[model samples]
Target: MNWSSAEIGVLAHAVSRAPSVHDTKPWSLEPRGDVVELFERFDVSLPRHDPTGRDRVISCGAALANLELAVRALGWDAQTALFPQPGRGDLVAQVRASGRAAVTELTSARYSAIFRRHSHREPFRLRRVPVRRLRALTGAASEPGVQARLIDPRTETAPLADLLEYAAEVLKDDRAYQRELTAWLSLPPGAAERTSLPWAGLVRRGTRVPDRITFASRLAQEGLLVVLTPDDTRRDHLHAGAAAQRIWLDAVAGGLVASVVTQPLHLPEVRAGLIEQLGLAGYPQLILRVGYPAEAVPEPVKLPVVQEEAR
Candidate 1:
């Protein structure tokens, strides 16, 4: 039942390319007989930015989605089980090949997008995303206990903008947060920049905060999908990450660009405000801002899906 070298290659490559908080790559892949276990690496810490390790767990969930998709793309029916080990808290998921299966067109497209998808943080084109495309993006995130809510630009933009601005203001003054940024900035550069770490609109010391009205105007032109879950728990965060990546890949396949926004939602006040402002029935885990790119950009370098060893 041990996976062949080719199978391990596919799984490792997909998991490595998953988008993570600050490109921390907070998960590892362990290929066992017929199954690949996804483990969260507790050593990868972002104490100031992700104080509760919520973002790190969510990042692992994103890796989980990619792993499953890779399995399907490899012509297998993937069977996924979460938290399969009772005492091993770091074992987030285990995906095994249930049977051989034909790869469907939908699965193929998503798998192809895994290498192409990267964060687009700059302003989008002024044109609005077609309503139909928005529907498809939301549908991608429609897993159990998960709901994708599109922020209504007309009615909800102003309040949401206010909350984001407040979060930015608070983080800007946080000395510890500033220190964390300084350290991250000091890290030696790596090639993963293209596949990860191109986020914009985050709070940084001395970064000018836009006025609420101006920020609201900017937000109204974008298509934002808020991924929510009924309860906030470790499992919920993991599910949210999976949903976020699914929606993101859908956007990429549809010729759109998007970036994830979880910095603001990390604040309790901003999280509470979103539920009230948007009349949401669940806790917002993250936001996917999707739209056409305002300008062309170089594609991320595609990495070979090859692994040297399996643990």
Candidate 2:
């Protein structure tokens, strides 16, 4: 079970492919003698969308899941310790690969999707995802202790849309929020070079801006609106990240594309508002926009893993 620097590099590379909100790969990897630890790297300068760093932790959790799977695929058994230390908030997870465990067929299949999946924000093909496939997605979300509610009723849809629009308007008017968004948005020509949100992923400037109403309307018109909820705790947020990654991988397996929006849900008011307006029972974690995309691409670049000195 001895792991060399080269082996660690390969595993770390695989971990970097996990998805994140706004492509903010907010994590640092530390390699011990035989373990890879993921630490949350917060960017305080950014505005309030992620005030509590829930999304950042979720992003790191997803990376941890990927790291485990990748290590297993490399014929090693990955033992994970989530939130290993109390009071020390930055350490998200520690994974150590040892012995030998063959990767399951399911893991092998999902591994390919890991590299191919990307957040697609563009319009999707006009088609409905089959009920069985939708169920599979729901199961994927539930696996990590999150609930995925698929909004199918027109009445429920209308209210959710309205709430989203209200939240969007609030964000649009907040200069600080706009400035933060602008900082992350990868402009037209240099998007690929930047590690931030790519302009290609954004709706055109003249296009109807994304609001709750607009988002729901678009989902009704071209895709499906899946509301992912959690039990409303910091640990729940971490589970939501794991669920989000699973669902995204399932979508890839089902020949579908997906995108996520947490901006609206970031505000406490918006989260409560959506719960009341939509008459939902659980806390909304993310709004997943899903449909068949025209193309799929590899995930954005991530910082190389810098192994910290052992304690």
Candidate 3:
């Protein structure tokens, strides 16, 4: 588990690229002896959109996956201990390097994809994803306690579209929600990032349409899926997050892009509607939009990801 300074930096860089709820990288890494510790930066917790810190913990879990993948791709086996101590919610996980193994092409490809994964708002290409590739995406959630399923776009389109609109109506009048949402948003006709980077808005505004109806309508033409679990405990939430990162990484390896939408599920009614409409046998933890990018993605689009050094 003794890691060189350079290896630690590579691991940190991989974790930094993980997707968070609002580009808020809510995790940090520390090298302790032979183990690399991943901790949750709860200070960035979103009260309006994520009341229970579920998304925050989930975000950390995504980073955890990336950390492990980076280690493996570098030819080291990563042995992880999740939630190593009871009642210590701040400690997301601890990972230590084990004996070296030959790095497989698959691992290298997935690791390379970590740097290229992104979210796009534009409609995907007209070509539908091959069934084999779609299945591989869901298979990434192979870790215990997680299950992923692709919703039948042909059957669930109308109701899925309605749920987006319903959730919009449900939260429209809440000023707190609006304020926090605006705080994270960097785009619109006149909106810009807090840092005054005008072009930053263009990247942040991916797939985020002004009208919910239009957003839902456009979504119908793309890939839609969910990651779910049989339980709703904290551990399950973490598992869901790990599954999400795996799916995203796999999508990237297959020349696809994705975005996540979990705000609407925060409302119980919306979650229930999803369960009833989709006939889910478990709790849905994340909703994902997957597709081939319709237009070229800008290189600067990924520069604004907010990450912090270990505290």
Candidate 4:
């Protein structure tokens, strides 16, 4: 059950790089001998943005994915149990080093991507992601009770844009929500004008959303994936987040950049609309925009490495 300083460092490095809601990193880690425990922090809440705290749980799920990958990349057989303690809702997952295994090229690539992956909020390069590559990305996310689907630019773009437009309107009108969003962005007083670019991010106060047609046109050129689960539950949300991180790491390792879009999906109506319009087989938890970066890659969000500590 003993862990070396290097082993503890790898686990912390991977988890810190996980994408979270507003970069809140709402999770903590406890390395207990052979088992590493991940806990969801209920203390970190985004009231107006994430009313039900679903996104927070999803964020922890991303961290869980990184933890498992770090364990495997370090040559351990990571046996993960989600919500192992039924009474402790906040404990998201526990990864145990059941045995030793040689690290595979794929696992190493994904683990390396943990640091390379970052949010690319701008438009993608004017190039199409090959159908084969897209298929591989989707396959990486095909976990139990989880499904990753690519949006068809040819047929589904218009309807998808309609939903996004609706979400923009809904978010724009909510003053409290806009205030929360602005606070998170922490935009300088004069910097608001620079955010007018199309597809910069989810809509906020004073940000102009392109018309439906224009928005659809821009979306048509982008590669989008929707992560879903058969039912809406805490378990499902965690699965969705894990699936998302796997796909994202795969994308990054393949020289692509991506970002997760859960803000728009936070609205009940938007979720209902995506399911009905897209004829989705399950509930859409989040949308990931993946593609070749159009310009210089933005720096990855840096976090302090995890220190060796037993809980």
Highest TM-score: which candidate? 4
Q: In model 4, which runs have C-alpha deviations exceeding 4 angstroms? A: 188-193, 196-200, 296-311
TM-score of 4: 0.92
lDDT tens digits, residues 160-193, model 2? 6666666655765677766666677766764433
Can you write out model 3's per-residue Cα lDDT over 58-148, one digit (the tens) per residue? 8887898888888887677889999998887789799988777777776776787788887654456877776567777898997787888
lDDT string, candidate 4, 1-311, tens digits: 67777788878888999999989999999988889999999999899999999999899989999999888877779999989999999898999999879888888888878988888776678897876788789998856889899999999989989888888778888999978877777656745445542344656677677888988988888888999899989999999999999999999888899888887788888888899999999999998888898666534433333444562
lDDT of 3: 0.75
Error of 2 at 290 (Å): 1.4
TM-score of each: 0.90, 0.83, 0.85, 0.92
Candidate 3, run of 10 with poorest lDDT? 195-204
| Higher-scoring candidate on lDDT, 1 or 3 | 1
**Of the candidates numbered 3 and 4, which has the greater lDDT value?**
4
TM-score: the better of candidates 1 and 2: 1
Q: Highest lDDT, which number?
A: 4
Off by over 4 Å in 1: 186-200, 296-311
Q: lDDT tens string, model 1, 151-257?
A: 88898989988888888878878899878877775433432232211224455665666677788887888888889998988899999999999999878877788
Better of 2 and 4 by TM-score: 4
lDDT of 2 at 272: 85
